[model samples]
Target: MQQEFLPQMSSATAFIDLSGLVNLFDFETKAAQAMSNLAYEYVVSGAADELTLRWNRQALDNLKLNQTVLTDVTKPDTRVTLFGHELLYPILIAPTAYHGIMHPEAELATARGASAASATYVVSSFTTTPLEKIADTATQPLWFQLYVRDDREFTKDLVQKAQALGFQALCVTVDTPVGGVRNREQRINFGLPADVVAPYMLAPGPQKNPLTWKDIEWLQSLVDIPVLVKGIMNPNDAELAIQAGVSGVIVSNHGGRNLDTVPATIEVLPYIAERINGRVPVLMDGGIRRGTDVVKAIALGAKAVLIGKPICYGLACAGAPGVARVLTILREELELAMILLGKASVPAIDRSVLWEKPDN
Candidate 1:
């Protein structure tokens, strides 16, 4: 039997108190309470049966930490360097579209929050706010997440504009050639409100021509900034991305929103990392809910990790402060995890920190 869509309290009727929210899930709970059923489903639902979505979190939980004790636990470093910039933490805000649905301030508020947390903010091409406006609000480094438009001229122009607007790198999303079969959204008959629209999307329909490796080469030829391929799940694809002169690769299945039964990003990180062999930075997103997850990812071979829904929850609840709080909790938790693991810095984390089951 098919399950019916359940309606939640409207954002207008719900009130949020950010002070009481202690963790990512806390914010998620509040955000769900404070959003319309349409909005919440848009943010939370995964593709089809959401098998990959559930697995993304479960796989991270299945890995047991091999904690160390009796070491100098003082001054644990959580800093990491990527693309010539020193990030205070290995955590970054994964790009999600249409922030206006969550808050009136939209991506401007997100930029401010990411700056306050000193985290890199990756603005989506489908951003509600203008790229220039987001750049103006950001104090920290910014990266642009691009969805190549069918119109070649517009895509080229957008990349040039992002470079001119001070976006440090290009994260070209490759997994979503077409919209996914989002059952939850379909059940709810969800659509963005007329008032909220993606300003960068000048044309009206879905992209008819999906991007290819040649497009990666074309983008590289057009700009000097580092280009990263997002949505890499296979080891061979990761190698191909490296050979295509990508500066980095994000191991993502579009946050489990593209395909339903694919392996979680965490499950594939090691293989992808191995295939890349340190040629370029390997980052992953999907199912990062705790600091321990961050530790596990680094130990397994992720140079950094990105969070998508958590940031939306924050934005929905308290705007910039909400976003800042989310980053702060993750940062503090990461420090504590490092101290407990006896690893002083992000680079010190390796597979040794994971507990492997003995052969039967």
Candidate 2:
């Protein structure tokens, strides 16, 4: 039997501290109170008009789960294998930068929280904490989210370092050719505190030079572990990713930050999943707010889902414990949904779970 990994929070609780939180949004609300206005905005805001950002959540809401009772779900299993390690659930902590802005412990706290929850933590290239330090703190699987710098050699060096430090995989972020203009962030003059540092920088600044397919090939040539290309949103792109020999695809729109009006991650997931056709693992992240949301993504054929802003929200609320509480809530909700829907395991969730398919 797989070890029980869900945080035990069924006991009586009052709304006093992080333990009082019941859901991801609850953490988000608490985080807003704990963090500065600028910090909160930076974590939550989307690019340009913010239409895509709002749409991410709206798209998930549009999907309704069809419930089926009178079935035995007493032992419904939530375990899933990704990159050769079994996770307690399909929800992963997406790579968001600069945890220090949310809490003093920074990425280290996030790493510890993820391990406690038995979920994968993809450390961002822009992490305020050193990767080695985060690696030491992690008890579960750790993957590095890479943003290729202008200096190809430096980027390669970072890749080597991550592998040496025991990162299980490399999730290369490809959507950001350039930074998006988040009006909310600009209005606040948002910036990381001076003490926060990106440990992987050769020369600190923005990495504005665009990367091509050749870069992916070079990255793969350097690392023995799986290299999953993040930021894929189109079927054609998914096809290219397969041809390029990537181990997986994360169907993301950079959490609606890189471009406005792009299709929601959920909206584009099925098409990409079809194109990949099980050739590689297809994961997604954008508007995952509930356990039902996780069910919908898996039903549409996502191997797993990554979470970004919510982890920041949890970090800001109460460091590692807050993050664990948020994951516990999500895991419990997913299990409840699974049992209610008559699914025996993660594999039992499919397109049949959806009440009706929304028009693409």
Q: Best by lDDT, which number?
A: 1
Question: In order, what lDDT does every prediction score?
Answer: 0.88, 0.86
Residues 171-219 of candidate 1 have per-residue lDDT tens digits of 9999887778899988999778999988786564466787889999999
Scanning candidate 2 in windows of ten residues, the lowest lDDT window is: 7-16
> By summed lDDT, which 10 consecutive residues of candidate 1 come out lowest?
1-10
Badly placed stretches (over 4 Å) of model 2 are 1-16, 201-209, 357-360
Model 2 C-alpha lDDT per residue in residues 293-360, reported as the tens digit of each score: 99999999999999898889987877776677677778888888998999989999998889965698
Error of 1 at 34 (Å): 1.2
What is the alpha-carbon lDDT of model 1 when measured against the actual structure?
Answer: 0.88
Candidate 2 — number of clashing residue pairs? 0
Q: Number of clashes in every candidate structure?
A: 0, 0
